[model samples]
Target: MGTSINDHVDRRTFLKYGGAASISAIFAGCTDNQSTDETTNESGTDSPDSTESDGGSTSNGDDEATEFNYVTTVTPSSIDPMKGSDNLETLLLHNVYDPLLYYTDGTPPELQSWLATNYSVSDDGQTYTFELRSDATFHNGDQVTASDVKYSVQRMMDMQNGFSWMWEGVLSPENVEVVDEKTVRMTTNDVYAPFLYTLPFLYIVNQDQVEANANSDGQFGEHGDYGTEWLEANDAGSGPYQLASRERKREIVLEKNDDWWREFPHGQDGYEVVSAEMVQESATAAGRMREGAEMADQWLPLQTYNDLANEDGVRVHAKATFNPFYVYMHTQREPLDDVHVRRAISYAFDYDAALTDVMSGDSDHLQGPLPGAMWSHTDDLETYGQDLEQAQAELEQSEYTASDIDLEYTYVSGLTVEQNMGLLLQSNIQELGGSLSVNKAPWSNITEMTTSKESTPDMLAVYLSFSYADPDTFLYPAWHSNSHGSWTSASWYQNDEVDDLLTEARRTVSQEDRVPIYEQAQRIIAEDAPALFVMNQATRNALSTDVQGFKDNGITGYRQTFHRYYQG
Candidate 1:
């Protein structure tokens, strides 16, 4: 059995392959924290057997259940596809909107034809032409047209936010043209290798609906807000589901699109309805999971999952993902401004302790700037380990004295693992004769602070996952100089050479040709030590045994496409 990084490796295969933490370590954590009085099922008393498929299978319409319920930490930040970028928002938008292409579940996830049946690139590699799926229809029952494709691309370029970075330099609005009712053409400034990967994010919208609902007195002059306000509560998409209702910070619902262009797998109709309950507390979500909830929150405490593992009808899935947890240093800020100081901080921290104590052996050591799972990742880059002598040596190379190295470290509030990791770093930094303060802030506040170089903390922890399945998805947004304002590049680290390398690499379409450029760039960025590459995270989820066909698609937001699951 392969790892779940490729969903071809199912949950049963993962357990058979021992993809989770060591059983002794997991059970040890459970014994220490799980209460003795928790409920159990007599039928579910048997030990988990790898042969019993935890992934869902097709049903013969015997079950009466229609709605698939899920627990989440928060409501989507926004429903407007061009405005929201967080996990919840992406999850919601991914289902509500269908993109030009879709990624089939795998290690190097392949781009499956979605809205566009086929596409071709021009000889110069500057232009792409896509043939639309003729039968595709929006929730409103309107046939999707080539003009809608043109408008979606233009709308993203005009909004200048939420994934606009992918096309900012490579494509212009004038380059998008409706060749006919079934064909649309896009021309880039130069050759862009990851353009196909990025297409999965270019969610198509009903152009006429958006134009009719646009607010006359708002932003995006002439486009008039581009239906941003209207889209906050409604969807104008051709996806497999339609928005039923939404209540910010509380709940959102989606109903199956009866007019969907494609039939679901195994003669099943897919989920008729999907409900997401916004519960902030992990314990509360875990309780719901134990009480027969189909899906649990993604970031629940490790102990919660360990306890749930013993429960009946519940399958806990822990899969190593593309997400790289980072401890970012504000490169433009003092002390951290020195590359030697940054390197010192990286060396002083204990990566082994982070895996053993903080992450509880659920994660893999990150190779460098990119997660090692990525095909373009290079093993040649230097990695830091806990060595106070080396740390002190690197610190001495900096102009600042040990006493002047007081720093502040921040992590997301309510995340136990992040808080514990912060404490571990605090203790390590204190040992080096420097004072360090650990702070916790809400995710909203952290994102707000990242808007400026001065506001971003001396050091902060966050996990970055790819929106697309290409190396550029990890490299360009998180490291490029042009992406400074976003939370992904909050470190404010910039290099003309690195930027040139990334820019040139993206313009080179061939994967073989791009490898050397990406390698050199990763080597440079790793040496700079802008952020401490902590670990590649393993996403842990408690799923109901009744739910099958759940795939770890290797992309963050698109993992839970409810339409793919079998209720029975």
Candidate 2:
């Protein structure tokens, strides 16, 4: 990672930098073209549910049955799905688990009868209908039922875990009721357009698991819900992969689930995972994938990936993804609490300079909340310019003078690249008649800053990668006022308008309808300036020359597809 190109940053100098506030650059690149109008995610409402070619990409006469099998340093933030989970984990789960409906190649999102083989919706929007897939069974061989869907959705709500935002509006206790052993319906209080995109993440539950940890009452909520210490270390799902073993800071192994529904592309299609395990976060794993290391199957530290790209026995792929990077202003914190102060803070950073000079033109400067991947992304909404004139004018309009405040920007230490962006930001803030102090926390400590009270700081420079291809990817808990985003809303800018817009966006069943709402909310967010939206990243998963068939479904970085992945 310390290695450098001829561009001002030398290998030693790059390594010498500490926190996120050491350098600044300008954002200089853009995606080659807009993503297809009717994007093909391969499944869900999109079209013909079954589409499969051999999993691997082959050019030579040799026929490869499988491809794109590799590992990375990232680990699941959580498996609960109802909490702060990892984007990488979601990608893994997408393959092993099936939602009520899913996005497939080039078609309208369609509901898959994964567990619910068939289903219907009530005449009123309040009730949703589903038919049980009699054959669909969990990894443990337990048949899934309508009650399981009811229980899982309810359990998510009852736990009040971080992920509840996904369904806060879609499923309510008063509305979702099962009609019989084979049917279930979800009726909404009102017309919600985005209801379909919402259910795909509603993974079914096993009554047995709920009963295993239930409270004194016959039900499984009260005290035994998820986010508790139990689910964090265990695994039992109707998925293709099962947790094999794990050691914190080391490696977590996931072996194939033979009982995994056994459906093509769904259950490994009856074919056994001749390979028993998938490893996570091991340096040994990284070493085996680096360039010149024949055994090197996969590696991290983008620099290493770049090196392996041209080497034999490995492969590399890079593409633009939907990850948005930004700097947050704690609405509850000082200076940030003021709209003008927030705007002034936003003006302090030279985002373009940071991306260009520091990142060496590898990123796209952010213009608004809904980046280009979405249908309604607008260039007019971008706000990352150094407008000293407007910033000063805004500062003058505010009641307090610059002398009354001091600012602190806290960042994670592992962000070798983004840390430099922070430094440039610190410099910009100083130019606006303010004091900007920088602080760094290690991964073990920095991560807590997102929620835990002890980790709360005045300001946080954060990055969000959403190229993994899901509407809820960044919208739900992150911006939904009642969710985790609220916990991080230091500026405390709570507008019923923005909230309602997000609500409408999620409830709208059609993305064309949802885009406007998403755009509206994004516009308000930009104006309020709670966060200084930076640039979107172009994800590059560099492997040796041999890796292939890795398709990016959009929410970049964290969501690299690996199912049926293999080495040459």
Over 1-568, each residue of candidate 2 has an lDDT whose tens digit, in order, gives: 1221120110000000011211332222222211213224433232212454332222224443232334544445555545433344455455445555543322222333455554555555445576766666766677777777777777777765534655665668656687887677777767665555455456665667645754444234354444234455555467655655555544445555555553334222222232212344334444555523222221233444444454455554554445566676776666667888888767767877866676566667778655565556655685658888877888888776776447777765445455566677777877887777888664334444556433466677555534223444555455667655333332335677988887776556666677677777778878878777787665444444443233343422213333333334
C-alpha lDDT values of all predictions: 0.75, 0.52
Poorest lDDT segment (10 consecutive residues) of candidate 2: 7-16
Q: Please provide TM-scores, in order, for all candidate models, with all chains considered together.
A: 0.88, 0.77
Off by over 4 Å in 2: 1-71, 92-97, 105-113, 213-227, 264-286, 291-302, 403-405, 441-448, 452-455, 465-476, 484-492, 506-519, 544-548, 555-562
Candidate 1: lDDT over CA atoms?
0.75
In model 1, the Cα lDDT at residue 313 comes to 80
lDDT of 2 at 28: 23
lDDT of 1 by residue, 1-568 (tens): 1111211111100100011222124434443222222122232121122123322322336575367888875455578888667676777888889988776544335566788887776677777888889899998988899999889889998887778889979999888899899998888988887787777778899999999999988888888878998998899988877899988778899877767786655334357778888887778888998888888766676777787878888877665556678888989888889999888889999999988777667777888988775777898888888999999999999988778779998977656677777888988988887888999877667767887887888888887757775788778988899988777787898999999999999999777899899999999999999998888766767788788666665565755878767665
Clashes of 1: 3
Deviation (Å) of 337 in candidate 1: 1.5
Q: Which is the leading candidate under lDDT?
A: 1
- Candidate 1, residue 187: CA error in Å? 0.8
